[model samples]
Target: MSDPAPVSTIVFDVNETLLDITTLEPLFERLFGDAAMLRAWFAELVLYSQAVTLSGKYTPFGELAGGILRMVGENNSVAITDADISELKSLIVSMPAYVDVKPALDRLRAAGFQLVTLTNSAPSPSPTPLEKAGIAGLFDRHFSVADVEKFKPHPDTYDMVAKAMGVEPSGLCMVACHVWDTIGAQSAGWQGALVTRPNNNALHAPNVPTPDFINSDLAALAGQIIDANTAAGKE
Candidate 1:
């Protein structure tokens, strides 16, 4: 096998990786009496998005989020209405970037890496997650899986990143907090970085593509990328 490819461009996963979804925990707690259910609901959102996509039907992320939140509330015997879902979604746009995100973006950009975002969210008429977090200008391009009608962890969705960024898959590195995302991207010939988030773990399944760099947060992952490139230059 050829040696691992170097990263020429970095594509980020936006929702939990850049904008912290935990900001919505209080709303879940108020409605369900348990903040931790927010994590479960999000896990369902991701699963259902891919489940339908894999079955050759596609549902947009926001719609899946609404449906899953209702399911979760019903399971807990809480009464969440359509108006409550709308109110919860309204909070999505106002989430601040995670503490590690801005410095990591600054470092990677300054070190000459082209930055881009590829999210599962549909193209929105309103400001997107990055725009809402005030970092839209940091990206060279922003792509949504809506363009391909597929949610990520699908090889097709990961493959689209290369075309959107005008590079070979090997020249791209996917930075994500989810192991499945890293696995999908690396499987499609890109390098991968995993940011260790709460309850997230290293992938250990047979034939899985392990992360090229695994760090506790984005700032540390950016440092890994920068240092790796600097060391390569010396040789």
Candidate 2:
């Protein structure tokens, strides 16, 4: 029997996976008088992004994010000022990476994996969030859903990465903090590795495809990928 193909390309989801989103809490607290509104706004952003995609409509993720923030502010009876939106945008593009991200990415690269990113955020003329976070140079490529006009968990979003990399879906592994993202990548025939970041985890539903690797620590997840690839005779 032949060995199965090894996953040589690791595709990462940017926002919460690599960048520390908790840093935005202060902005949310200032805007809505509640730090918890950070999560609320993010959830709504994801929900509406997918909703519009499913409805055969398209809106740039950045614009949609700003819209969601305003919607949250209005719901809380707080006015979202232009300056507030500008600050939010600045903070987003300047969010720092989780401490574990760089080391794990370095380890994976050393293990001979091609590392790249797939983000729902649209392309920016300025330095990207990853670039601003000081890790963009480490990636071989960065993909945005803006090109596909769909938000993630949509199969097309995952498929676009495989197509762009010129590799079969089976040759890729998606490393993400979101279960929905892993499910989408897996459904597109890529292996899934879920980094169980705070407030993120594997959802074990009978109909859902559980991730192939799950760890709270990205370094541990990198080790697992390395070990598996080594065992499969990847050099």
Candidate 3:
């Protein structure tokens, strides 16, 4: 049997990739008045996501956010009301994108690449921070893993993206700052690109699958993708 064709669609991981979650730290600290507790809460939210997926229990990302915040409150000896939790959830929907996002996305689009965004966030009442960032229209499709009820490093979540985008796993490149996410995509038979941002220092697990490409920024990645596609006759 012949191998599948080279990649054609470029799917991005939203949170730490296109969007900058660091901007939300001040907001979280202001709301909780404990920076350390807020950081721990964010970390725990990731832990819970994996736990829930492994246990076959699914919760919306918004619900997980609230639950994590409440856990932070409990740990910090702070009392948080339901209303406060609701407001905090709303704030989460407004987190800003990274400064380089718009130009990078525009370059990719201009290069004739099909662009899509795949996020672990839930479908919210209002436009997500990506939409607010003025780059939402740049994406051919925006998908939330909420539909699949799974999180990153879960094959199901990556599969949901491939199915929705109407592309074979081999024809898609999953790009993210998170190594685990890229590893998951690679494991699921998709090409993967790891964006090596400075603050993102999580080590790839031993014996975990490595991504097809790793670059320090999207501009570099865009160039590499174009060169790769040209060499593969996909351009």
Instruction: Provide C-alpha RMSD values for all models, in order.
Output: 1.8, 2.4, 3.3
Pairs that collide in candidate 2 are none
The TM-score of candidate 3 is 0.87
TM-score per prediction, in order, is 0.95, 0.95, 0.87
For candidate 3, write residues 1-235 as lDDT tens digits.
Answer: 1122467799999877887666667656776765555557767888898899999999988798899888878877878789878877766777777777777788888878899988888776546577787788999988888888888879988888888778888889888988878878888988878788755543556777766677887878777777676777743
Which residue pairs clash within candidate 1?
none
Question: How well does candidate 2 match the true structure in TM-score terms?
Answer: 0.95
Candidates ranked, most accurate by lDDT first: 2, 1, 3
Q: Which ten residues in a row have the lowest lDDT in candidate 2?
A: 1-10
Candidate order by TM-score, decreasing, is 2, 1, 3
Error at 72, model 2, angstroms: 1.0
17: Cα error in model 1, Å: 0.4
Superior by lDDT: candidate 2 or candidate 3: 2
Reference-based lDDT, each prediction: 0.86, 0.90, 0.78
